[model samples]
Target: MSESSDLVMPDAADSERAAEAALRPRHLEDFVGQPVVREQLSLVLEAAISRGNVPDHVLLSGPPGLGKTTLSMIIANEVGGSLRLTSGPAIQKPGDLAAVLSSLQEGDILFIDEIHRLARTAEEMLYLAMEDFRVDVMVGKGPGATSIPLPLPPFTVVGATTRAGLLPAPLRDRFGFTGHLEYYDDDELATIVVRNAVKLGADLTQDAANEIASRSRGTPRIANRLLRRVQDWAQVKGNGKLDLSAARAALDVFEVDQRGLDRLDRAVLEAVCVRFGGGPVGLTTLAVSVGEEPETVESVAEPYLVREGFLVRTPRGRAATALTWQHLGMAPPEQSDTLFT
Candidate 1:
């Protein structure tokens, strides 16, 4: 495995720092997509910095790879504040959180990614730290123990979560502003591709940018990745300029269809339409039927499927839509209830 993959899934703090260092968006303008989030955050940061106080705790909720981490860094930069990275899962003990909290400077931004996974004890301590800028730290062993009252600097906590619904009500309510990041539109993703291409010093055309954007699965990171791959293809197979035809050919070779469905994406649809007769099936059943991980099916495959109207999420489970049948060159069943309704 790669060094990054073998890092034993370090605590949220280390993971957040690595993510910040590796893919931190350098400037507000360079941060791609989620324009509303940018505008809202800009207002909050400007207002807070103008008043010379840490901004209200910010809760950023979104699916993975939609720039939640990047936005957190951008907020820190905009406020001229240092960011201390951490996550919910990393905080195994209240003391772990107290150590981090006690070290923070006034007006510093503490970014907690995956905030939903925090330990219960740590979460309780954080409630006090967040609300009153103080943490009661336990000293020595149990029974004959002492609890030291430690005061923390006034710091802004920015929490990012893939599953915001899992966060407790008290924790969620503490944040003054909540920004929900949505998937990028194709145009926004195209702009993201073009921007990264310029940064990477690749020659990219408008049509090529659009083609790449269309197949980026509506994510800036994916758009950037695709751009890098296409650049490599251009270097070997054609002139270094990424023209539309070259982009299409490169993406085809990568098994990325024009509709943005990848090999695994097609596999899910194929399993449903071909194997399960266009399932109105449970997620576990579908996962087992397709021989893939259930989380992968829910996280990666289902997002695109629902976005493209090929799959529907019902109380009963996941079911293929009429669009799925049409896309797979099969007819919709007669006398069937509409999937969306």
Candidate 2:
């Protein structure tokens, strides 16, 4: 079996950073999926622009690779403002956040990715900055310390998080708009694949695009990545064109199954179904059996599995669904119905 980390998971790699940036949609209209979010966000930005004021602080929460960062950039562009990019982990102290906040220009968009991982002190400092457009900067040391109120420009903050539930209520409640991005459907993903292929100057047929979309685990990032791989295969193995055959062969080489289950995905499913008797197994236990971290199982693998109806999370533990047994070509036990129930 391949190592879990080798799987074509949704997490971004350092090498793909430039490619992702290049593929990002410049405007909300160009964004392929999340119709409701695109419309609502358009309204919000337009309303703010009409008033000649900065938009409210926006919060975008969803799984990785769903374009939170891209939307944040779009928000900045639509508002005709500069975007300052940073992450939660980068701001280890309140001073770090204060420096960034104090440097902001009027109508600037501060995009903080992984906002849930922000340090508690930094988070508290952000509340005042977002709400009052000011930061209470402490000067001096010990008992002689004094808070100097620093007024900031009216700016918009676009916060992105994979785990929105981890955010404190104070921070969460400060955002005027919170958009939760859902995974893309196959049709939506297919559209994204075709658009990306055009940008890459690759020959991708509709059937080829559909094949890649179906095996992309319903994520545009994955769909584009798969298309790139298929393009390479087509160039070397056949004519320099991406067709259904080229896509299938390339995906097979990469160990992506018909149902889009990569090696790690299969490992998780197998561990749950075979090792744990179709499991009511705990997530940690299941992760252990598959030689992975519980976070990897939960964030990377399990979301797709559960979304595809191959797995279930019961209060007792993680369990396999009837579809899982069928996918594994196993006849469920007599008590399988009770397990699901």
Error of 1 at 44 (Å): 1.3
Q: Candidate 2 has what TM-score?
A: 0.91
lDDT for model 2 = 0.90
Instruction: Report lDDT per candidate.
Output: 0.85, 0.90
After superposing candidate 1 on the true structure, give the runs of residues whose Cα lies further than 4 Å from its correct spot. 1-24, 331-341
**Each prediction's TM-score against the native?**
0.88, 0.91
Candidate 2 C-alpha RMSD relative to the actual structure: 4.8
- lDDT by residue (tens digit), candidate 1, 242-294: 99999999999899987889888888888877766666678998898878889
**Which candidate has the highest lDDT of all?**
2
Clashing pairs in 1: none
Error of 2 at 12 (Å): 13
